[model samples]
Target: MGKNQSSKIFSPELSCTARIFTLTPHFTQADHAIAGLAINHPQLVATSSARELGRHSDVSEASVIRFVQKLEYESLKDFRDALKKELVNSQTAGNSSVSTQPNTPTEALAQVVALCSQALQMLTTAIDIEELGRAADALEKSTCIHFFAAGGSIRVAQHAAFKLLRLGYPAYAQSEPFSQIAQASIVQSGSVAFGISFTGSTKSVVDALAAAKENGAIVICLTNFAGTQVTELSDIRLITPAPGGILAANSAQTRVAQFAILDALLTLITPRCEYVEK
Candidate 1:
């Protein structure tokens, strides 16, 4: 594999297993078998041979080979090499490091509060005023606004859309893939499209944003990472730090950060909008 491709496969933003799961709808039986192993026993997949993996996953050795190939690996050896590197990197970064679980509900609630506070603090430290201003400027100038998201992020998109609507902006948030793509395709110049994906890897949101950009709409992305495919298609980016761990992608911390960003952006745009006229 090329250096850049290998780097992406080992990126900390998304584990190899998470990447596979994200694209699981297109997977076959063999792909499912390998992906299952990657998710449940990543260390085993990194250390074991293709034959061993096939046996454990209840698939043929040939199927094992095909599975790696389907993930864009050049060969079984290449896949193992990347897996090993990712495992090492994750270990070094202490991705699995966390305090012991709370023994009681009260303790757990306290821990949750602590984590949320830290996440919001991090958000405040990382936010760039200039970028938020730029985003607000884009929104203020747009004739219409479309919010695109899927899965858990659709809630955030819908919330933002409602806030903008109440402020008299022409805004919409569509959860269905077909409706999102249709709206993106028809958005005219001076329109703004906001794509929300915590991992910034959701194909539907990425494609819809790309479609909007192609049709002359300004595209903005609210994602956890800047280098992801979804961000690549955006004209402006509002980024939040990823909450680390197995449930990182679904963390409430990230959701809180997204809401905070949305609130700030809306506050900035409210003064620019002629809400009284509407």
Candidate 2:
């Protein structure tokens, strides 16, 4: 395995990197160039030619072969076939993560099974063990943490605060709007602030993140959407796959994913600390 393909568990927080890690199970060193190209420019994955993908990723044709080998495919045709399957799996998994009822008994049962399966797939694909280590280290070394979430995001904020506190970290979640601003005002250097939103467009959350940044806190964003406003201000933006279908109400899935990352973070920062009492 290459230096990149270490056996680490990534937090769903490092969405982009985690996705890159998922490709490891399916790609090889030969496919790296094209795969990286496809991921960096998903637009190319659709209509672009292989030569175009090569040029865009700034890698050579030989590198594409190496990438395929890493993925463990025998030939280019095999790799492409598997790649198509992976895409289908990702899309299907996306739809299954959210449970939107179809107004029928049997349909609901099917949806429930699909939803559970999707959650497993998402959580599995989204974790990158090494990058998660980095995030954990950041959380551990920081002296304080300020959290912000609005509307749908508030749940994540609350859950993160709960975990951090239990881990004995100095963490606080902002509730009142002005309280967020006031807390941001006092964030010392070497602190971290988290903002959670699916769309990454919540104004209050954005403003609070800005304040945290101005006060010298490292801003971490938990959002699913790419190219959203909040990512512009965040030091790290963790992306979750958009929950679709009947499971839309299960924001708890997202929250649980966040907690998983927190668990990783806590583990790294305080490896010796006992998580459970005997």
Where model 2 places Cα greater than 4 Å from the true spot, the runs are 1-110, 243-253, 271-278
Residue-level lDDT of model 2, residues 66-157, one tens digit each, is 65454445555555554455545545534432324467788756655664555455766755455555567678888988888877567667
**TM-score for all predictions?**
0.63, 0.60
Query: Across residues 1-278, which tens digit of lDDT does each residue of candidate 1 receive?
Result: 25366544334444454445334435676676677567546678988898899899899998898777666676888788877776665444333344466788987776666656655755654555567789999998889999999988899999989888878888999989999999888988889999999777899998899899998999898887545688678888777655353346666776888899998988788543465323
RMSD of each: 9.6, 7.3
Which runs in model 1 stand beyond 4 Å of their true positions? 1-99, 271-278
lDDT of 1 at 29: 65
lDDT of 2 at 249: 35
